[model samples]
Target: MKLAILPGLSLDEDELEITYILASGPGGQNVNKVATAAQLRFNAAGSPALSERIRVRVLELAGTRATRDGEIVITGRRFRSQQRNREDVIERLAELLREAAHRPAFRVATRPGRAARQRRLDGKAHRSGVKKNRKVRADD
Candidate 1:
């Protein structure tokens, strides 16, 4: 099984290992006879294909996906057929990798626009003028 790679990063199928286990749900004798649930294990800590930074992010993102032994585990059983479940798992795994592969876009520092600054100054000036006008004269 294979997953669609993200735009910038490419992953080989060899990096991913999938196992199909008996699905748990209604299906009569078919449920007992066939395996439908798909379990995918990817070694993020050991994969040379991914950058160390991306690898670390992957581990962080996976969280519960990793086992005590440190293998990422993703399971799928939304579909009754093993083929469909398998595809779902692969798609999900690819998405996870794509998310990890992404780096946050650089944010450009920006100051308030000229018009915005002028507006703020205008508001302050107006407020000050109001306060000045509110002062009562001694004669009044």
Candidate 2:
């Protein structure tokens, strides 16, 4: 199965290693007996589906979830069912990849307009005038 992230990027199911583990918290007795949590490991750094630029962004965005080996480990235990958890992890991974695929618009450096600079200077002058007025006159 291929997971489509962006228009050009798709990840093969083989690239993902998913395992089931026992989930902690809030499942009562069922939590101990059942391994419902899904752990997904994806080698983002080594994936052929990603270009160098997208790979770097994905790893950076993964933050602490990414290992030094360039594998991104995502644990999904939000749902009680193994299938739901599996789906959750896959969706999360897709979201991460989608975000990384986006390129931010280049920001052009801009200077303040003449009117804006004048307004700022006028405000400063007004403030200076107010402070000057606060001082007591020697003649008074």
Best by lDDT: 2
- Estimate, for each residue in 19-136, the C-alpha lDDT of model 1 and write its tens digit: 9998888777888889888998888778767788888888888899976665688999888898888889878877887888888999999999999999999999999999999999
Best by TM-score: 2
Please give the distance, in angstroms, between residue 67's alpha carbon in candidate 1 and its true position after superposition.
3.2
User: For each candidate, what is the lDDT?
Assistant: 0.83, 0.97
Task: Write the residue-wise lDDT of candidate 2 on 1-140 in tens digits.
Answer: 89988899999999999999999988899999999999999999899999999999999999999999999999999999999999999999999999999999999999999999999999999999999999999999
- What lDDT score goes with residue 67 in model 2? 100
**If scored against the real structure, what TM-score would every candidate get?**
0.72, 0.90
> The CA-based lDDT of model 1 is what?
0.83
